[model samples]
Target: MNTADKPNPAQPHSLSANDMNDKLSGDPISNVLLARWIMRTHFEQFAGSSVADIARAYIGVYSNRPTSWQAVLARNHNMDKSEALRAEDDPELVRIPGMRRSKFLIPKSMANMVFGATCLPLLDHEWRLREAELTLEDYLRIRPELIRFASGSPVRLEEIKSFLGLSGSQARACTTVATYNGVLVRAPSPNPWSNRWLYAAAPSELMHSHDALVDHEQLQWELACHYIEQYGPVSVEDLAWWMGISKKLARLFLEKAGAGEIESGLWLGPLQKKTFESWATNVSESSDERVRFLPNWDPLLMGYSPGSRHRSCLGLDQIGAYDHAGNGLPVVLIGSKAVTTWRVTAKGSQRLLSIHLPDDILQKDQQIIQEAAVMWAERIGAIYIP
Candidate 1:
């Protein structure tokens, strides 16, 4: 009696392409959210000593200020009423307010984020402002002292130039680039700060690679990766438009990344226009009419264009921008389209989430929106009763 072991005779042999996609992205949070996860946990995780916190504090100072390493030394003196910057002048320096140490050394403590880690620098800079008494607007003005950034605090992304070690035309160029990447503001020169505010720090984290460092490359790569990962069995051209890459570069990059079509002989996006092809066969016909609550800078809104750049995958009408300054509303995506908008408001200790729908929302879909709003509130830890 020869008994052969069959391949898991009780279970199905293999999953189809659709099944595989569903498994990976069942509760899919787009690539943008995934990037945040990588920033906090992988690329810029606080692995080293308290030195990481030090680096973060100085990163904010240098990126937005005009002072030099030497000037910083002088400022240290001025801060201590000059005379001298003895080790103990601040033996009680108290770790720059960003930390709780009373005997922290400025230079040694400021190394974790200065080297290679990208987000570390940003996290530190933002936190430092939390300790300041100025408003973001005051910090960026000609006189930070006059601005009252302390109405409760310092300006964050808008004043990133206070960090770099650059000057002249190069400084201006850096300011522009930083602004584009979501750095709030850029100053031409520095005053009490320093002139090192022109260049960019490492972006969110160690982005994917290659073009990731380049201007639009990382965003482009992200767009492509997102499309394929979420809606694969698609084409390269479909990705290119979503990514805003040149057709030629898009093709080259896709090929370089070693992506292949499960279906042969055709691509989408930039290449499809020339060859007349589509990735229809790979998509699932049954898409949920679920209303997803998304942030203002959500990946789809940022990447996809109304032009023929991308396939009309989602029907978004009037994409609403969520205010970073204000507690914003969640954009309502009915099915795969952005139909209307809604937001939750807080009055005193009570909170209210509101929605404005265009078409008649079904009883079930409305329930989804309501539950989603509740979940959103819970994530933000609001004390809403109903």
Candidate 2:
């Protein structure tokens, strides 16, 4: 085996590195290259770092998506010392002290708010009338209420609620920081997917009183980069599917990164060309994919939902748990494919993980797969320790 093929010492690609850089035309901003740039731009901050921890940052910062309390903490705790995953780690979050699970969500209100704050890392949000669904700019241009400062003056929760016509429960949810303890109400008109929240750095991001900070375009750019860089060699359809956005917006954003034309039907932006070299050599090695066990909301699973070009990649197994009606379970990742199924059972001190790998896997693959499973379970603080 080649030295690089040994156990992926470097941080795993946040998305699908297997296919990030491919041929394209007209514009250099092909989905493959853009996704690689996303991963390369962001994960480089934590290169060779723990894949799980890095994933947390990508989901919170780049994706700008709100996460469930359970989801955020689990990812944080996937590493051995989850309790220590964050200074705020707690027993409830961790399966064991310092061991927890993490979930993430990206809300609509915060998306625009994050863009306005200039706190998001890169990319700019171009406000178009159609995009925001507001034909009259001035009508939607109302500024945030004038906030006065006075010594010993505390923030009146009700005042904020009255401004937005929110209920007491909704107010509590907005105040929730790291651990999701409240239910932020969904916006009724412009954005109905509102109210929901995802994970973020507690002290730094979530605490910000404003909603716009969550969906800022820089974060979106970062997310776009993650999808392409990590899951590149992909297509526009994949990004559209993963993000739940329209293809027009996806193409528009990809083009913004200065993509350039390559061959007659191919385009390669500066970043895309750069990505081509990084994984060019790795392709042959990846030709024969392996069996991987991915938790629910896996990047691949979540990326290609309906309205996506590669909609089928996620498969039924990864989504069953996320059914709008009930709690979803983890999925069995087979190479780039989402195949088979799995469930975790906790009998007091021990957690039993039963995985049903794809029937298609060969005996040789199965043997190798079991090894990865042990490694994965132990990594996520599985009580049975594989």
Each candidate: what lDDT? 0.34, 0.38
Put down candidate 2 lDDT per residue, 1-386, tens digits, no spaces.
Answer: 31111232222223343343343222333343343333333323343344344444334322211112223332332323343234223211111000011233333323222223223211111223224332323212321231221012223445545654546554333333112211121111111112232222232223242354355556656556545544443455555555555777666656675444343323344555666656543433222233345455444445444434233333443434355632234654433344566656667766566666556756654555566666555554453222
Q: What root-mean-square deviation over C-alphas does model 2 reach?
A: 11.6
By TM-score, the best candidate is: 2
> What are the root-mean-square deviations of the candidates from the true structure over C-alphas?
18.0, 11.6
Our model 1 lands, by Cα RMSD against the true structure, at: 18.0
lDDT of 1 by residue, 296-336 (tens): 32333333333322213333434443344322234655434
TM-score each candidate. Answer: 0.36, 0.48
User: How does model 1 fare in lDDT?
Assistant: 0.34
Position 89, candidate 1: lDDT: 27
Model 1 misplaced stretches (Cα beyond 4 Å): 1-238, 241-243, 256-291, 307-313, 317-329, 333-339, 344-352, 382-386
Task: Give the number of the best model, judged by lDDT.
Answer: 2
Query: How many clashing residue pairs are found in candidate 1?
Result: 43
